[model samples]
Target: MSIKSEPHAGNLCNLQDRVAVVTGSSRGIGFEIARVLASQGCNIVLNGVSNESAIEAAAETLRQDYGVDVLCCFGDVSDASVTADMAKAVFKKFKRLDVLVNNAGILDDGLLGMMTQDQINRTLDINVKGPINTMQAFSRLLARSPSGSIINISSIIGREGNRGQVVYGASKAAVIGATYSAAKELAAQNIRVNSIAPGYIKTDMISAVPEDTHQERLDSIAMKRIGQAEDVARTALFLASDLSLYVTGQVIGVDGGMLI
Candidate 1:
């Protein structure tokens, strides 16, 4: 038996006509994904909460740099009605949504014993329910497109469990669970759903950890280095494009062998 090697180069504009909505994309990992998609000619609907000015600035940059249409929707994905509104705005502006990147998530770290109901609800509402609600609102629109994808950004904590992140882990775990079930349900419509479980990606999210504590977290990674936002963005681009057309329902780890 002969092994096959993946092709090294291809045209990068395969997503020229696709339209995408990337939640919490004003900065960090989400922003990087938006940039990656836009670079490939995908129209973008940039999402964020309390970052209207930043969102507009990012959107303008995408339009100027990539010459693609970019619309900014400011809202909290955790709110059901707002999630629906975000979808509506996209449809109204772009008339199609080929990609939905559920990247809006909040992390509240605390031992289970000290975690409050408010903390648990806040984490779950955004990390888990936000994606679900967003998908529900736009599934029909996605189905209308010939090729569609839903990318749920989960975490390694969801799979292996992490101390001091009981509630946060629960929310991410739910994202992984939904990824499998939703992909199965939406496959017949030719719409794919997948989740990306990133290990120690260096984003603003990591700022929550103190400097010394962050160093310890980095030491635990087998790669001996943390990943950048572009690392996850490149993965999102692969899943969003036709390159991974046959892949679905998979929880891909962009985690430098951390799961091992």
Candidate 2:
């Protein structure tokens, strides 16, 4: 891990030939983030729990479009053994990992009293424990890079109270806590840990909202528009590359002023 400072201009080199793992990257925000990194000359390891064919296609698309190596790691990130296997595969293929995007998460919206035990457990496992498992598995590999970046995808609801999202929001808030502690623990190794709290991003979830509810959401945003996945992806690009070497332990809002 390199601690030597470099000007932002020098970040122009971008992550040429670097390797990144983006979980749940078969579609939506995760895929966009992977594509953004690939566009920057970074090789990608696309991870997904199900949808094996979609994951493979996404990896192939990256390889064809960006002309960078892409591998598929299929498993639930909450399983430590799965992440361990993922680390082994990465070592065998790329032999190094420079960036880790913990983008695999799920939402189970229900009031605290109405939520089923299964829903709560699954959300916590995927949204909270998933990042923990992957970070632990890949920390050693990441440390070997010039500098490593860990980008955890949280949500604006995590930073604020949202009705019907109590459990899910708590899970995301836990990720921010993890980022703070991880940044401190990994700083000495030149590994930066941070969280991206996106607000009302354009994704499948947003697409499913009722038309009236959707309009209400748009009205609440200061920007008066929904955020695009690219908006978050570009921010991820900054964090994944040397551009954010000096930035860590932070929660960047790609929320279109929704939080402010």
List per-prediction Cα lDDT, in the order shown: 0.90, 0.93
The TM-score values for the models, in the order shown, are 0.94, 0.95
Q: Which stretches of candidate 1 lie over 4 Å from their true place?
A: 1-9
Query: For candidate 1, what's the RMSD?
Result: 2.6
- RMSD list, candidates in order: 2.6, 3.5
lDDT of 2 by residue, 202-233 (tens): 99876679999888888889988999999999
Worst-scoring 10-residue span by lDDT in model 1: 5-14
Q: After superposing candidate 2, which stretches have Cα over 4 Å from the reference?
A: 1-13
Candidate 1 to truth, TM: 0.94
Question: How many collisions between residues are there in candidate 2?
Answer: 0
